[model samples]
Target: MSATTQDAVQHHDHHGPEKGLKRWIFTTNHKDIGTLYLLFALIMLFVGGAMSLVIRAELFQPGLQFVNPDFFNQMTTLHALVMVFGMIMPAFAGFANWMIPLMIGAPDMALPRLNNWSFWLLPFAIIMLAMTLFLPGGAPAAGWTLYPPLVLQTGDAFPFMVFSIHLLGISSIMAAINIIVTILNMRAPGMSLLKMPLFVWSWLITAYLLIAVMPVLAGGVTMLLTDQFFGTSFFQAAGGGDPVLFQHIFWFFGHPEVYIIILPAFGIISHVIPTFSRKPLFGHDSMVFATGSIAFLSFIVWAHHMFTVGMPLAGQLFFMMATMLIAVPTGVKVFNWIATMWKGAITFETPMLFALAFIVQFTFGGFTGLMLAIAPADFQYHDSYFVVAHFHYVLVNGALYGAFAGVFYWLPKMTGHMYNDKLSKIYFWISTFFINVTFFPQHFLGLAGMPRRIPDYATQFTDFNAMSSIGAFGFGLSQLLLVYIVIKTIKGGEKATGEVWEEAQGLEWTVSSPPEYHSFETAPDIK
Candidate 1:
């Protein structure tokens, strides 16, 4: 290594984690707090995943075998609530907390106290949400979408759910703002915008999207509360309010919410693909432009979700076309990944396997999305198992797969121990195969006219339901390996070097394994 590189490594060695649990809990240090956030998110993933198992088990047969319709609704609502708020979003934040400063060669996040406050709010919020399950009316049955008329019909648990959502929204908004401030203000002295890693760029955009949309959700839910308690008619048709308006506002926030979840995954894959391919990222500028275009388009496509709620032909056509336009940017990203991998020396590490799966699976999900984007065709597919199948592919195959890849890719660096490679591959293969088995058949069932949100199905759907259920159980069981791998790595394993992957490049690689509590206390020279 050159004199400059040697000097950078020495500078990094001077700063590492300070001792104790107090440091973790009360930590303003980015790496410490980042670990806390990640562990919390992983715990919530299992909690949320367990809830999905219940939903799947109930829907396993043609009838409600495990839960009543009301409780089933609670399971569905909480499953989505936990997954979005408790799992995926936090996981991305965890990534931000850990990787952002390291990638940018900053000492820590911009505002550290606020970081602790933001994470602390999550556990309390989820607990409040879970408490609703035991309440008199057995939790809010209005689904995670939480539309008005039905939401108003919910029991005492409704207030708790509302409050919990408020807490989550607050947590998210705070995190977003912190990230924005950090990236804008804390880059190393010489690092310029274009010189930053793609992950940083992606997150910078995502944080803005979060800040822009979360308040809209807060406003929508607040309106629901007023319509319920204050005798307002915001969504009550009887009092000259339109219930459909709730969907309008909700989807306005909701559409952008989808981009918020997936964009980080895009950033991650951007980082991972080039590393494994031994090439510079193909079309880096285009990838950045594509991500921005997708975020902009997200705002206008909200109405596509409401096509069946009675929109004008022109309105429908406009939404369908705009929604379809998202495909161009998304397609650009897909092509970029393929080009990055073209005839390159690629290795199937756990992370790479998952990324490859993400490309194929997310594309399939995208195709299904395109099918649904059509106003006329959506009329048939609306509220069907097909919709469920589509999102699961995106969420499970896309977001969750990306999360897995990230964990495996970074495990060595984060824990300073190499995980069991054999077990990691087993985890990947089983998860990939069973995930498809679990959700793929639902596409056919949905196309054959199976409606979603129903407690039971017709006899004709029984065989596919059984197969899907079995797949669900298999998928759930396979995750145990993931838990085991993480636990084992954290406890002890083969020692890892500073550069976890031989091909890895970036400021993060300059730091030792299990990076310092206050990484980059002195900025490193990036060139």
Candidate 2:
């Protein structure tokens, strides 16, 4: 290396992370905090994956072979909670911490200390969640919906689960507040809201959603705690309260919570598609507006999840229409992505491949979602494996795939070294292939009348369940390749230049790969 660049790096590291664990504990640096968030998410990814594998294993032959029904329920419940909070949400936040400031030319997050609090809070929350496994009742197994009466039956573990949820909610709200403030106030000169990167725009919408919904979630759970212990009637059917009220509150938070997990993914797709296609994102303004519209519509469509709850026909129709309208904005995004790729110099790089798979699979999930939105049809699909198939399509292939694309798209920039292109591509296709195998059969099973969260099923499902189990193992194990690729790139590889991708756009690509510890020390001119 040139002495000049070596000296420059040394100078940058002077105030950077120190040689021990303390660098992580007391540090306020956005990059360090971002690294911590990413690593934590990785840990949770494995934890959640293990839970899912167990679930698949028990369901393999569907004969009560591996685990009993209650234990099986525990696996399913913790798997959803762990993946949603410990893995997917944090994964997005990790990317946000690492990329947002760079994209918008901010010196650092507006609330760096709060960022640390948010990151640190996650471990404690997840630990509290994990602790439930050892409690008397073996975790809250009434399904992630946590409907009362059943949830109230949870033994000593109930408090732990509720408290864990509250902590995670607190973390999300704080992170949202920080992101909103940083973006609203921190953009470099001339970087207007419209001119900022789509990622920034995506997160802005997500932050608003988080702020709106997380507290409602906390309140709902808190009410559950009071009802369970304090003899309140908030969800007690015999008392003056109603159980459906809990569904209303939870879904109010839950529907937007789904978007909170995905909007950042849309942002990731926007950036990745244009880059690999060697084109600008089509209808950028419309993309931004579409995201906002989806957020607004998310609040109204919560009832789509509750169509089976005997709502009046008028109410059901309203929710069904609102849910369907979400497709308009979502469709705009899909078309814009396709248009961005149309007739362009497209390259099926690893990120592009993942992004493409995400589009296709997530769309399939969306179709099922629309079907479920039909209040009449939902009677047949609700709580069935079809619903399971729809969400995994949306989440694993949709949100998680975007996380994969973002990691690969930015790994070079994050590490100052290019990942092994061939191995990464292999990882991508393996995951893509097996993920389909794992979830696709469930669509048929759902249609054939298999309910979710069951430990055993009829003989007719044996073959498909076996295929799904095999696929689940393959898909779950293949993710470690990502961990390996990331480590290999960091330890040593082809040294990356400032611009990792050839046609990379925005301020992020303008800086050094593995950009200095303190990025944007002096803001760059946006124009």
**lDDT of candidate 1 over 1-527, digit per residue (tens):** 36466557677466444576676767787777777888888888889889888888988888668889888888888989999999999998998999999899898899999999999899999999999989899888888889878898888898888889899999999999999999999999888988888888889999999999999999999989988899999899999999999999999999999999999999999988988888889998889899999999999999999999999999999999999999999999999999999988888888999999999999999999999999999999999999999999998899888888888888898899999999999999998888999999999999999998777889899888877878888888998889899999999999989998886978888899988655676678767
Model 1 gets an lDDT of: 0.89
Top-lDDT structure, candidate number? 2
Candidate 2's C-alpha runs over 4 A off are 1-14
What lDDT does candidate 1 reach at residue 275?
86
lDDT of 2 by residue, 229-328 (tens): 8989999988899999999999999999999999999999999999999999999999999999999999998989988878898999899999999999
Clashes of each: 1, 0
lDDT of 1 at 48: 87
TM-scores for the candidates: 0.96, 0.97
Q: How close is candidate 1 to the true structure, as a TM-score?
A: 0.96
Please report, in order, the local distance difference test score of every candidate based on alpha carbons: 0.89, 0.92
Any idea how many clashes model 2 has? Answer: 0
